[model samples]
Target: MTKRNEPLAELVTEAGLSEGGLARRVNELGQDEGLQLTYDYTAVYRWVRKGQRPEPPVPSLIAQALSERLGRQVRPSDFGMTDTASLATRALTYNSDVPGTVDTILELGRTELKSRGMQRRRMMTAPFVLAAAAGPSRDWLLSTLDETFDQDAPRKIGMRQIDGIRGMFKIMQEMDVMRGGGHARVTLVEYLSGYVLPLVRRQHDQEAVQLALYEAAAEQAYLVGWMAYDDGQHGLAQRYLIQSLRLASASKNKVLGAHVLAGMSDQANLLGYPEEALALARVGQRGITISDSPACMADLQILEARALAALARDGRPKGSVTEAVRRAEATFQHVRPDNEPEWARFIDPAYLYGEAAHCFRDIADTAQIDRFASESAAEAARQHRARRGALSQAALVSGDLQRNEIERAATRGQTVISLAETVESSRCIETVRDLTKRFKPHGRMPEVQAFQARAGQLLKVA
Candidate 1:
């Protein structure tokens, strides 16, 4: 890799600024975002001469500073730090080829393991861009699966190792459900980087063993993506999920690929992209055999219902929400616990009811909200899943508020807060926040005001 800063030097020269002048400008720009930087000429000199990379937002800030100086649009790539700095940017993209996608995932995993600050990076909920997913979805749809996975090397891997990986993923997933991804997301990424990546990278003689390894690797990637999602890193989660889809396709595992797409769809809907979410859900449905995985089928349909409900909330169409809900219900009836994948084990009646309650709530269907939310709460408690229970209770608060039952809603709101007090889930926190928003019209009342005070205090502590 080249360790030169000729481009930055040229840009600095073109702007007609000395090293001290550039540093002052950069610091002034940093102040706009409440950053107190005391950079001087030496800092600028090292960046332009020694090929040092500026910290994030700083790179963008540098671009902004130069853009203002040059009176034009300048990007970070123009800084001549492409070899090392560009890996992070490239990691977010869904590349067209499998090897390129694998490279992106590997680079991201390595960074996440090496840098605590990167692991702690706040998950920005940027508005969903439809174009971002279009090409990846098309590539997955049109690509042909590999007929054989044979390799010519001495290092042999077998099914036992693959099964061990799968079992570990299941354990990690259980941890995710109970404690949320905040608890173990970083550790899991480290495991993927240190252990799982090498196993898949090794050569194997048997095609079956190789496929199994890739399938296990894909599942691990999907879990990593989900952890990122739960930790609020929406864009990073999408990139990991796209890589999971590519790996699953390489292994000739359509059901697993469909599951990855389902996750992407969920992220899209959660971040407020109903159209793209619904389209991704439909893409998950294509080429999946019904008998192969009933639970996954139900999960995809329910996600489609979720996207439809979101569309209704945006005032696009109302009828599709109900119809989608019905389809989800019908599909869920076929879920055979004995035949389902372990990853989809959580997609039982309680989960479906919780999702349905949100859908009905979105379309302002108070009757369905009452019915589904109540049922979800009942089943969630029976299943010992506090996160879902809290969410359902929050939905009940929404339902009660919709029906003008202020005291009942406030009481349920308190229950959600109590249930979520010990959990580290942003989704649960946001649920309570949404319930608070629903109480805005009745904020003057003492019961609602008391609930508001308690909820705010709890979240502040959390």
Candidate 2:
């Protein structure tokens, strides 16, 4: 059991806030950030009297609340909850050495396994900040290659364990494609903590074996991050992606590192950091070696175009969006499926077209969006990819809205809602929200109202 938080109690006393008062302030802060926190005095009592730590984002929120009440800066360390706060921030560091990177990544997996409270709490529900992403991204961009991964106490392991991890990665990827990331995240974390860590710590002699393991671990970590992003756990997703990037660097896998950066760019764009998103995408594109991996390069270029398109949507600038799209298209033409990495297998023309639809949507090119969305939908249907199909349908809904075809748009909106109901994906939910929010101006219409009501009920259950 943890010790009592006497320092917190003292601070509470000095701030002259009753337990109830502190709880009220914290709840208010959560609500302002769209979090549904219902803490009362009892929660505060536990923190002060029992030393029970609150879940992440909460510790930071509590510190912020106390800072306001005390008319001074109050940090998590001030309350002896530094580790809890740092758990979220630690991944932002690109360790100067390989062992440090490995330790950090392993610890993250262990923490996720041990902290049931943290797993239950939606710590990443808070708003996204570009500032939080800037440092780690810069560190990754400027990082030198790892020289060695010397362990203090090394044990030799073999290809058997590495193969096991690779097999699991394949299974998890298939499951993610079929059932969505929400369904896969819990299982992925379990595998990370239960299998991968133990194997990594075991003995391994061959440098090739070690490199293979590191790359596999990096891919798995990227999957963890990707699933988190799909579940709308943006902060958690960023942390995992950072660790993945660190692992990719340690393995000297520039292609995989580019992939990791692409994921970061995607997350940043979704979280409203369009500028940082674009920068991340460009970083990924620039980091690639021409002879290293053409598939990786094409993927990064597409992601860069995606970021520029998102920025254009947000009214930043439209000129770059078109050029970015053109460049992505041009690069995509060179992807050789037979030579692509396992991770890049999904970056087909259909995927590119679907993303291009988003770019067209951003630029208000309704006709182009319609064409691309149709192509994406047909391909998604052929492949039985529900998530991508829903995304394509989302673009179509927006296009219908742009054409002032309200009834047709509402119909497509309902289809998206129905498709979303079959998947446990936060990305799907966000798509519904975006479409529903656009429907607000026409809410009085029966179709729009019906779609919104159903979508709301679906989200509530999710």
TM-scores for every candidate against the unseen true structure: 0.78, 0.77
lDDT minimum window of 10 residues, candidate 2: 147-156
What are the per-model numbers of colliding residue pairs? 0, 5
Over the stretch 125-210, how does candidate 2's per-residue lDDT look in tens digits?
A: 42345676667666666663323333332222356777778778888887777678888787788888677755665567877677
Model 2 misplaced stretches (Cα beyond 4 Å): 1-82, 118-129, 144-158, 314-316
Q: lDDT of all predictions, in order shown?
A: 0.77, 0.77
**Candidate 1 residue pairs in backbone clash:** none
Candidate 1, residues 1-462: lDDT per residue as tens digits?
436598899998998889999899889988998999999999988898888877766777777788988998666656743222445455556666655666567666765654344422432332234566766666666653323323332222445777688788888988888777677887788877778877777778887787777778888899998987877777777778878888888777777888888898889889888789888888878747566677787788889999998877767788888888888888888888876767888888788889999998888899999899899999888877788899888888888888898999998888899878867777877877787788888989999999999989877876
Question: TM-score winner among the candidates?
Answer: 1
Model 1 Cα shift for residue 258 (angstroms): 0.7
Model 2, residue 127: what's the lDDT?
35
